[model samples]
Target chain A: MTTSTRVSARRLTKRFGDFTAVDGIDFEVRAGEVFGFLGPNGAGKSSTMRMVGATSDRSGGELSVLGLDPSHHGTQIRSRLGVVPQEDNLDLELSVSDNLYVYGRYFGLPRRQLRGRIAELLEFAQLSERAADKVDNLSGGMKRRLTIARGLINEPELVLLDEPTTGLDPQARHLLWDRLYSLKQDGVTLVLTTHYMDEAEQLCDRLVVMDKGRIIAAGSPRELVDRYVTKEVVELRFPAGQARRAAPRTDGLARRVEVIADRLLLYTDDGDATAEHVASSTLQPVSTLVRRASLEDVFLSLTGRQLDD
Target chain B: MLPTPFRPLSYFWVSFRRTWMSTLSASFFTPLLYLASLGVGLGSLVGHGQRLASLGGEDYLSFVAPALFAGTAMQVAIGQATYEVWGACNPWSGAYRSMQASPISTGQIMAGHMAWIAARALLACALYLAVSAAFGAVKSPEAVAGLAVGPLTGLAFAAPLAAYSVRARHDQPFSLVFRLLMLPLFLFSGTFFPVSQLPVGLRYLAYALPLWHAVELSRSLYAGTFEPLAGSGHVVYLAAVAGAGLLVARRSYEARLSR
Candidate 1:
């Protein structure tokens, strides 16, 4: 493993009896980068993250975290790694600050130093005012922030977050994204798993699109969009049920044509050229929208299925 | 001496501080009330001479104090070990999973919980013993020797219960332990009376339990007599149960938490 590689897995596999959760998959996470596992609910993203966190042992494959084999140096590897699970497991009985203090103590950090560290983490999570409140009393966003703060109490080298914003409002999601971005700025390597294309597009520098139990595609959001989809897409709406009938008229106008629901999508190298042809053609449409291709289109083009189901 | 690297006791200390009031009254006061109502109030009706002879020339309060200490140890240990393991392992709390993600090993987490239980059991026993003394139930200076029985009795239940608790998918399994196993052991384990007075078959059944061994050992200590072979037998029995329980618990915690 290279010094820059924080996590490296070769043909990593996990099986529960006969049902495989994670098939043979190869991936690597480097230092100071936001790496994401973008997949649906059952795509085995969390299973992979658990193995990398050194909490779950892989059934087969060579896996290393921070240049140490997890099977042999699990505790040593975990000492340098931090994990925020999909669920909030903060001590519901303790105050917000106590949660950080107790979690820091689990890392064997001295009590004298943890006081200042907890204060700093509380500030970073924007939860300084609610430090003394019970964890249960806080809102969903505050609890999530506190959980992340607890994960950072030991000042880890790499942090693994599993769906950090799964059930949060838009404002809460943005606030959490800000905190994570600041952590990335401080050079904390992040490995997160989420099914949200927008989140992956917004946060990840590199990501892998997984389906079933395998990674079907891996690249930056821009790279995957460029590799899998055309440069632009023209959305044509032909009032009510005429979209399916209008799709045939645009067969030769665009590189690829697809009719989904009430709209027909025309994928082309140049959307303006495609739109000009549609305007002058025999086809009659109500409205048209032209936009750049995105990861959502990439997922559909590669899998023939939508990412959000 | 310096604390161990993880200092698992701190987990229990912090948790205890938050609920010490309830823990104190519930675990610490139950034994005192039992001594007052059963050992004193009921002892008044049994009459000193007849009861003394029947209890082997000892007052009802003195004879039952050590036995109750052993029983209380079993109660307190089981109470803490079972629920805490369940709570920590449950998906909602996932405390053990959180700890497993840290530098602490599964063994350390299990050990830390055990250490915390030991501290609570010891404190409860010490308080019970002190209250026993104030009740004028002190028969011999060796009465303090009953102190060891508390933790041993508690651990005898705690370790194996912790093992069971980790594997428990829900709270339903614990009720079988409470209704079927622990209650029978508490009622028939010689805590309230001498097992020698029990029926022949029931006496043999009582002899097979760890609490019975703990009670006899504590009684012997309070009575200021030394039966080396018998003492060794009781000690060996409790030590074996505790050892086996610890082994099973370690394996269970490892299997459950390290997955």
Candidate 2:
């Protein structure tokens, strides 16, 4: 990924009358990088994506896409940007190939060129065999792939995906991740939002963690983990009734200790040392396991709440 | 360069190509059948005489052709204007939403939709005129002028409905348009019979509606009895309605989509 910026926003915000959806936030995305917005639902990730896509005007802020102001040059900016909204909006009246062909025409692409491109894209999406099939007949994963393929029809320079894999099975999510990896290898800038921590860790070169319309943290996923949490964590689960009472006994053994429902999480620099400390203590009577820190750990420490909750 | 607002017409044409068969059957054949059953089957009883004298002393079929032309245009235009616009805005297909992400702006999408509606009205009117001619409904060569009037009537309905449909979150209101608005216009406008036979109040009301003006304009053109000042009045009315519809629809589309 090049260091040159493709999208820049300063104090960008969006408000729906009485409610603020995207609070004032600042960030920049570089060309050819897999940038991500990591957030839970209602975190304003989709609202921000809409602004960068040039489909939704920013309520207040200075925002530039492809170096052009969205209010003045929205049409021009959108011409080169492909967007996959959180939901699949494929035309149900058209076939698989027609969906791509119809969307390509919106870019003012010539019919002759679109025919060839549709063929190539169908193959790229692994949907060549379903080109003539009606879009209604396609499975959920197939529809998602077609939506992504439709986004690529114009050969856009930057692609925005909002919650690209929200409701997909693990297998389908991985397949989409593979296609996205291939796109990144081709030097196309990628921006996406996801609630899945693993998706952010696996695909994002740089990302921002958003919560409640605000950017709580911004950095590479690894960097955020390193900054907000320790290197390792030990999971010590006790019987339900005894877990809350067992929390204070492991306090001085680690940098921090978190008591969730029935388990105590010990955060430290060394998992083996923490696990040993937990074993010798009278804190745990059920099970103990140690693992490396993750984005989930970082988020839990930052918000005092679980990522998926 | 083609105006930026009309650029989405290309997208409309591509999608229209796939559904032309069903679209043609609805917009063209349905009107053709109406002309046959109502104008011919019913007109046979009201054959050329004083019984038909109130119909401008012409055969029932010939007198009704222009009104049907206007009515058909309205039908075809409003058909695309409603559910199709709703479909584009709906989260399901989001055709307009998808286009909004491209180089096309909201005005362009509205222009393209209206253009497609006009295209359908053109085809439907031309085919209906031809069917009427086959049944000896054409009184003069000037009947072709109704081809132009067809889209104007269609736009008179389409432009307003298109604007309203963009803001519609559900389709229940669209069906109400047909039942409440369209049905009344078809029956009260000078489509089935001359407005001269109506009560004085309803006659003025008929004159106030756009379709009545369309029916009069198309009929005068087909009969070669064009009155310069009167004809200009009809033309001006339809144009004003269409122009106003375009202006309002443009603003509506711009406001709805930009958000």
Candidate 3:
């Protein structure tokens, strides 16, 4: 009920016929923070985002966005909340500036104000030079940036981004992350969904891992990783078929040993000791690596499957 | 400031600004070409036949021009509504999906789409009327009323086609609608010949169509031969068809976009 809580959902549920897309989930996003929903495909992340965006109707439970119920106040809530869908829906026939202009008008913003706002947004998205260019002519990264810029046209207090940088290359993804960081600095509350573990670690201040329409874990990225996984991970990839056989030789040397495909991952506080211990054992591995544990490791530990799979 | 339902007009307005030159040329020349080829050229052959009396005792050129005006309105309106409405919901464009993210409701988006189609129909019909007038087809000042009749006929088709377009998963059905339904109505619905010339059952079928009512209403207006009862009947029929189609289209848009 407080003003600082931008979104609050208590046991929110969404069902499509016989299947439940978001099953009795609970989460809250505070103002001026980047919140994330991290899950693999079919994890119901986008479905939950749509419910919070006030576009899809919830079949059960209570939901409040910006202190308004979406069922009753969808138009009002949406007026103040910007949304960037998973797909870029820019008007490809219109100029970059006109796409922003037309979307601004949908909020009933005056034409005179929108003209200046469009210029500022285009500059913010780093697309000033392409103002008159058709959206069809822009590269994949440029189009994604333009979609983000268009969402900001209403000066919304809260923005919901669903998989913002799914298809972009590494360089473009970094540029987008910088823009998102700037938005956070401007005191805008952001709720985004991404299956990318690095993106969740780098951008999200707090996040929840969803799987099969339910939130299995929730916390800051570091907290989730620290609580669920060890401080360091030792990955041992044996020659093709020997990984499963070598798993027993590394028992009790670490907190946990997960045999994934051709690699045996040892979770331990001291990855170097674990790697050295494995080297001294009877097992002869093809490759060994020691690295800091990440959200991907945490997800794998929780779900028993890779995040990207 | 525009109302909530009309806010989407800004999108169409910007689009029209870019393509209006080509649209205008098409609108101006399409009627001109039809009138020149069918009305003037074909009229010369039909004028010497006994079919002249059945065309309400008017010249063949004048008789066919008014029907073409109403027919062109139907074509323009259907053309505007089909691909644009389909593309709005399709993945490539997703224009409706984008608008659904804003404050605009699905009903408002449908209203804006229908309004834009009506506007285009009005513009195209007005041009068709101008071409008919230039060829000495218009009989009286009352013929100006055909302008309203033209767009109404267009809406009669556009609204229902838009309803179908919103839910269409592919473009195959649209081609069927055009080839199977639209072409038959355009050719046989009393545009070029009198409905009385057809066999009894086929004549009744033509009379049941929206285009036939439009052609009849337009010819009456252009010839200054408006009948009190029949004129009211045609207007009511066309209005009802348009109003019913709009209702269905609004619901279809809501079902598709709000999901």
Candidate 4:
């Protein structure tokens, strides 16, 4: 991950009349870095991406992409930036290659240049064989690859992907990740939003966890885990929110207790020892297991363990 | 050189291409059936007034021909401003969202859709007018001008509806459109009978409708009867209505797409 800045966002805000979707968020992405926005549903990740992508307007604060103001030079900015919307918005009526072609045309790419680049991007995304196939005829993975290809048509300096793999299966998501990785290796800067912690860890160079229009945490995958959670965690299920009620059970067994939706995670150096302690406690959890702490834990710790309304 | 000025034209082409075939197939048959069956079959059953007003100035088909042409223009406008609007603006799979991400501005998108409305309305008006002419409804050459202005009328009527379409938060907007624009225009636009012949209370409502102006302009062109002689106001009213619609549509596009 090259650490030269490519995307600079300062105090960006999006207000729809009275409701604020993104409340003054600031972040910077360097060229060749796979920066990510991690948050759950309604977390303002998409709104932030829209603002940074140069499509939607920022209600307040300064925002810039590729050294241009989004408000004044949106068209020029869009000509250089690529955007993959949250949904797989491939033109169903058009073929896979045509989707990329039409998108390229929109950016005012020369036909000759776009044609050759489409051939290369098709091969890069591993969909050259499906070039003639209609978008609806392709698999979920194929559609995503096509979207990525469409984004790359402008040979963009920064590509904004809003929840790129939100609905993809494991295989599809991995294939997409591989394509993204290939793009990164080529020195293309990518900004993506995803709820999946694994996705962020796998693709993002550094990331931020946003919740309800605010960035609660920001760091690299390892940096965040190291900063917020222990190396390992022992999970104890005590039926529904009961694991949460038995919060004091982790006092002697491990260090800090994180009560998530389904289980209580006990942060400890010795996961097996923590599990053994859970078995001995008067508070009988329904189940007990040991595993490594992930970004999911970091997210909970940073964004807060409380449920949002 | 700035490539081409087809950004608006291409946008219209894309929208028009989606349903143009179906619209063409339907419109082609609508006028033929209405003119052939009604002009011959229904004309024999109706009285002197029907025969005179419709086809022959003596045929009911001829008399109602101009009205149907205007109504069809309104229908086309309504269709574009409603179902197509929903398809284009609905959050589920809005094309505008995708287009907004590109270099295409919100104003360009609105221009594209409105242009498609006018283009499709004109095509339908041409076919309907041709059938009316073939059936001996139009006595003068002026009726061809009806086809020319029919789409303009549609553009005027559909623009406000398109504005509303952009602002529509739900399917309920279609209902409001029907009650506010479509029904009121259809019932009072001098589509069936002359607005002057209607009750004074309802006549003013007809005068306010974009479709009424379209129907009057179309009928005048068809029968060479450009009377009531307020020629400048008729043209001004149509242009003003179109201008208002454009202003609202541009605002709506900015509201929906820029958000």
Q: Which candidate has the highest lDDT of all?
A: 3
Tens-digit per-residue lDDT, B1-259, candidate 2: 3445666776677677887898777766776788888887888877632235678877787788778878888888888899988888886677887778788887778888888888888998888888777777778788887789888888888998888998888899999999998899988898887899899998999999888988888888777777889988988888888889899999999888887
lDDT of 2 by residue, A156-244 (tens): 99999999988999999999999999999999999999999999999999999988899999999889988999999988888877788
Best by TM-score: 3
lDDT of 4 by residue, B45-136 (tens): 66733545433353565666777788888888888787677667664344676667777777877877787788888988898877788878
The reply for model 3, stretches above 4 Å from the true place, is B49-51
TM-score of chain B of 4: 0.85
Consecutive 10-residue window with the lowest summed lDDT within model 1 chain B = B1-10
Order of quality (lDDT): 3, 2, 1, 4
Identify the runs in model 4 with alpha carbons over 4 angstroms from their true place: A1-4, A93-98, A110-139, A237-249, A270-288, A306-309, B1-5, B8-19, B38-40, B43-62, B172-184, B225-229
Quality of candidate 1 docking, DockQ: 0.49
Worst lDDT window (10 residues) for model 4 chain A? Answer: A300-309
- A248-281 in candidate 4: lDDT tens per residue? 6467777788777768878888898778777777
In candidate 1, what are the lDDT values of residues A2-117, reduced to their tens digit? Answer: 88999999999998889899999999999999999998899999999989988888999889899999989987888898899999888787788877877887888888999999
What TM-score would you report for chain A in candidate 1?
A: 0.94
Clashing pairs in 3: none
lDDT of 3 by residue, A1-309 (tens): 688999999999999899998999999999999999999999999999999999999999999999999999999999999899999998888889989989999999998999999999989999999999999999999999999999999999999999999999999999999999999999999999999999999999999999999999999999999999999999998887888988888878899999998999999999999888888988788889999999999999999999889
Q: What are the chain A TM-scores for all the models, listed individually? A: 0.94, 0.96, 0.98, 0.93
Score every model by TM-score.
Answer: 0.94, 0.94, 0.98, 0.87
Question: What's the DockQ of model 3?
Answer: 0.77
